[model samples]
Target: MNDGAPQGWGAQSTDGVRLQKVLANAGVASRRVAEDLIVAGRVRVNGEVVTELGSRIDPENDLVDVDGTAVQLDQSKRYVMLNKPTGVVSSMKDDRGRPDLRRFTQDWDERLYNVGRLDAETSGLLVLTNDGELAHVLAHPSFGVTKVYIAKVDGRVTPQTVQKLVRGVDLEDGPIAADKARLLSASTGSATGREESLVELTLHSGRNRIVRRMMAAVGHPVVELVRRQFGPLHLGTLPAGRARELTKVERGALLTLARSATSSTPAEDAPDTRDGDPSAE
Candidate 1:
C-alpha cells in the first residue's frame, strides 16, 4: 500500500484543499492533531494511506476514512431519525390533506426525506436525510437493508408459523419470507375477547405492508405494527413523534453500511424503489 502522498503535493493547486485543514474543518481533530494522525498513518484518502504532510485533496470528490470509518466531508449533509407516529404519512406533504412528515422536519433548514416509508399505520425508526446517494442505496430492495418489526396480531402465532415465515410463503406479488421470526408474547384481549400475539420479524424486503400481509397469510392478521430497527439504526427510547440528529458514532456506522452496499453493487444497477408502493411498509 502506498503510504506516501500523491505526486504534485508541492505544487499550488486551485481545486485541492489541504489535507489537515480538511480534517480539521470536518471536526476530525484539531489541525495539529490531524497532522499527527496523518503521520501515524491513520488517515486514508481514496483508499490510499496518505501520510506525507501538505497533501491536498478535493473534499467534494475524494473519499476519506479515519480509523477505517468513512468520513462525511460535506457539512451540509443531515441525518435524522424520526419515531413516526401512526396516522402520519411518510411523505413531506400529503396530497389528500392528511398528516405528513413536515411536522417532524420543519426545524431543519436542509430539505430531508424519509429513507423508506413505514406507511400511515405503521410507525418506528424512520430515517430522514438529505444524502441522496445513501438514501437511494438504503431504500432499494435490492440492497437488502434489514429491518426489524414488532407486530401485534390477531390469534396466537405458533413456532410452526414462524418456521413457515422463514421457509417462505407465496404472496400475491410473489414468494416472500422473513429473514427471521419469533413469537415474543401472546395474550387475550380483555374487552374483545380475542387472542393476540406479539411477534417480531426481521426482513430485508422493502415490500409495502409486508409484515401485515405475511402475518395474514399465516392466519394471524396484524392489529398493530412498529419498526424497531433499520440497518444499524435503532429506535431506542426516542418518544413517538420526535426526531433527533444522529450522533457522530451512529453517523459513521450508517455511512459505513451505505458505503459497503454501494461498493458491492453499483447504485445505477439497482432501481430506487423507496418511493414505490411496496416500500411504504
Candidate 2:
C-alpha cells in the first residue's frame, strides 16, 4: 500500500498511489486511462517502465514519468451520480463498441468512473466519482452498502417466494438472501388477468446478476430489474438517464451508513424494492 517506493527505494509515507491513481495523479488521464497505460507498457517506474496493473508507487521519490513527461499529481477530488438508464454500460470506456457514460461527463474537468456496476439491461442509481478511496470502500463487500432494487417478475408471486427470499435462498454465490423482501402489490395481467406481482428486494452483497437470479430461484424469473437506492442515497425523482451530484447531506449519509453498518439501520427516503409503482419517465 505504500506508494512511495518502487524497488531500491526507502519506505516512506509518500502518499502511496494505486497504480491507476498514480497514472491519473500524473495527469496521464483518468484513472481508467492510467490503468491502460500500466497495461500497455507506457508507464515507467524508476528507470524501468512497468506494464503491470497491480503495481503501486509512492508519489515522492518514485520516479514515475508517463510518455516521456514528468506528471504532477492533481489534488482536487470530484464525485457524481447518474440515474443510469438501460443501454448504458457502467464503464469509463467500452471496448465492446457501445455508447459510454463518458460522453455525458465531457463537461467536467476531472476524470470519473462508476463506483459500482449496473447491468446493461438494468437501470437506476449509480455513483460516479474520482475519489478512488471512497469508491473502493463503498463497493467493498465488507462495508456492505445496501442496494435496493424493484424487480418486475414474469408471473404472480407466491407468498412462499417472498418468505423464501426473506429467509434466504441459495444461489451460486452461496446462501444468497435479501436483507428484506416483501410484496408491494400484485395485480392480474392487464390483458389476460393472469397473476403478476411486484416485489421489493434489498441486500448488501454485490454479486453479478444477483436480483434476477434470486427471483428465478423462487420460480419467478425477473422480467426487468431497477435499482432504487444504494445505501442512504436514492434515485428519488431523478429521471432515467439523468444525473445529479451527491448533496452534502447525501454524501454524509453514505459515509455514516458505511461506518455504522448493522441491523436496524434506517432507510433513506428513497424507494424500496416494491412493484406497482409507476415507471419513472
Candidate 3:
C-alpha cells in the first residue's frame, strides 16, 4: 500500500511507527479516526488484530489490513495541478457518460483522485494526488486552506453584498463567509444596463456549490466561475483541460499549508460531512 516504500517510512525507521499514524498517513482515514479503528479492533498487523492505539508496525515487513482490506502507502504519490475545463466532472471517472477529467489525465498510470472537486460547471485549479495524507490535509477545513475564484455574474457585484459575504451568510447547513472579495471588472450584460462583471472571491468553506449558492443568495447569479488559486498554487497560464505536476515551490507551499492545520478533528466551523463539490474548497 505504501506508494513504493510506504509514505514517510524512508524518512523514519523500519522498526515502524505508531499503527494509527501509519493508517492515517496512508489515507485510510484521519489519525483520530485511525485510532478509533484500532480501538474498535478493525485494524490488524501481520494477521493479528491490534487494538492498542500506540502499536508500532514495520510497513515493509508487516501486512496491515482494515476490515479485511489490505492497506499500503502509494509508493509513487502524485501531486498534480490541472487547469480544468467546463463541463468536466470533478472525478476522474464519470459513471453517467458525462464528461470528466479522464480525458485530461489519461496518461497517468496510477489512479489519482481529485483532491477536492470542481463541479462540471466550475473550472480552475484542481489538485490531483495519490498521497493520502496530503489529500486528507488539504481537504480538511481545519487547515483553513484558502482558495480563490473568479466569478462572472449576471449583475454588477455590490459592496454591500461583498460585505455580507465576508461577514458570513447562513447556508442551509451552516454559516460561511468569504475571506476576501474584489471587483475585477464590470460591463453591460447580455441585456442593456442589466450589467455583468467578474468578481474575485476567496474562501475556505467546502460546502457543495457554495459559490453559486452564495452569489445567487445575493441576487447576482453566476454565469461563469473559474478557480484562480488553491492555497498558494495558482492556475497561471495552463490551458483548459491541461494538467501538470506541481512545481517544487508549489509543492512545498502546499505541504506547509497542510501541516499548519491546528487539529486532527474538523474545526467547529467545518461542515459535518464533505460535499463532493469543491466550489469553495
Candidate 3 structure lDDT:
0.73
Candidate 3 residue lDDT tens string, 1-281: 22223433322434568888888877779999999998998986655687877577675556577776556543376788999888888765578988877776667887777778878888899888766666766675667778899999998777777788889887787888889987888899666567898888998877788898888888888988999998889999999889998764566566545544532344444321222334332
The alpha-carbon lDDT assigned to residue 281 of candidate 3 equals: 28
Q: Please report the candidate that would top lDDT against the real structure.
A: 1
Q: Which candidate wins on TM-score?
A: 1
| C-alpha lDDT score of every prediction, in listed order | 0.84, 0.68, 0.73
For model 1, residues 128-199, the per-residue Cα lDDT tens digits are 998878888788877778999999999988899989999999999999989999999999988779999999
* Model 2 CA deviation exceeding 4 Å by range: 1-75, 191-194, 258-281
> Under the 3 Å rule for N, CA and C atoms, how many clashes does model 1 have?
1
> Candidate 3: minimum summed lDDT over ten consecutive residues — where?
1-10
> Could you tell me how far off, in angstroms, the CA of residue 138 lies in candidate 2 after the best superposition?
1.0
